[model samples]
Target: MLGQAKAFSSFSTNDIQQTKAFYEKLGLNVKVEDMMGEMLIMQLNGGGTVLIYPKPNHEPASFTVLNFPVQDVEKAVDELTAKGIKFEQYKDLNTDEKGISHQDDFAVAWFKDPAGNILSVVKDK
Candidate 1:
């Protein structure tokens, strides 16, 4: 049925231009379109797309809206941090100095966009 259909995710931001610039700085190929409404299409390096639209009263998601799987969580954290991205710290999760938390066999780190939408980088298992 719909199992083979390509699916994409969409989220809202208070400012489209600021959100677009934040993502572009991280090296993601972003395409801006203005159809019925303005949208920023994020082309992920691993073959996926996310649509970001502008909203007048947008509130960032409390939970992670996107997760990027990386080969090395440490290296990924380091690079992103050096690019001025601040990682979130969860005290109870026992995060390291890099703000990465490890549990079981995987590691994960979280950060937020200019709109305060949470996003994460996780160890590819």
Candidate 2:
């Protein structure tokens, strides 16, 4: 029944301004809203929206909350690294020097937002 609903994801951040700046640095289209206090609306590339709200006692999520599909994981990693983004290294994933894990048919790299929420760039299928 809800299949036609235009649902969106939401997450919490401690500082809205800092989070907004960080996402802007990544080239995302972000806008600030004053609804129920300060919030962020991020417009994704292909088409989708994510709502970011401020929480005084926010704790970062342990699992990845967002994933961006890129044509080349290596290129995406390089560009983000040049922008001062640091990729995360996982011991069990067999990640390379750039923190990208090469599996049988795809590659993926992970990084955290300014608020410590996990995000990733995965090789597009």
Candidate 3:
């Protein structure tokens, strides 16, 4: 019944200002809406929205909470790195020096937001 419904992802952050800055600096249009409190509405390119609200006991997700599809993982990683974003390195995965893992015919890189939530940039295949 919900198949036709338009769904968007939402997550919690400890600080809305810091979260907004981080996302905005990455070139995403972030709008802070005050709804009883403060809510960050991320207007993603090519059409999509993500809601980010503040929570007191916010815990970073162990898995990737968001994934951005990029044409070139290497280029994306380089741009982010230049913006002072650090990439995560895994133990067993064959991640290169840029912290991108290539396996199963797909390449992906991982990074974290200011609030410590894991986010990723996947190679568009």
lDDT of 3 by residue, 1-125 (tens): 99988789999999999999999989999999998699999988777889999999999888898999999899999999999999999978778999999987799999999889999999887
Q: Point to the candidate with the largest lDDT.
A: 2
Per-residue lDDT tens digits for candidate 1, residues 18-83, read 999999888899989996688899998767999999989999999999999999999999999999
**Ordered list by lDDT, greatest first:** 2, 1, 3
Q: How well does candidate 1 match the true structure in TM-score terms?
A: 0.94
Model 3 segments more than 4 A misplaced: none
The whole-model lDDT of each prediction reads 0.93, 0.96, 0.92
Q: State in Å the error of residue 77, model 3.
A: 0.7
Ten residues in a row with the worst lDDT in model 3? 42-51
lDDT of 3 at 95: 84
**Deviation in angstroms for 52 in model 1?**
0.4
Off by over 4 Å in 1: none
- lDDT per residue for candidate 2 within 1-125, as digits (tens), equals 89999889999999999999999999999999999998999999777999999999999999999999999999999999999999999989999999999999899999999999999999998
Q: Which stretches of candidate 2 lie over 4 Å from their true place?
A: none
TM-score of each: 0.94, 0.97, 0.95
Pairs in clash, predicted candidate 1: none
Order of candidates by TM-score, top first? 2, 3, 1
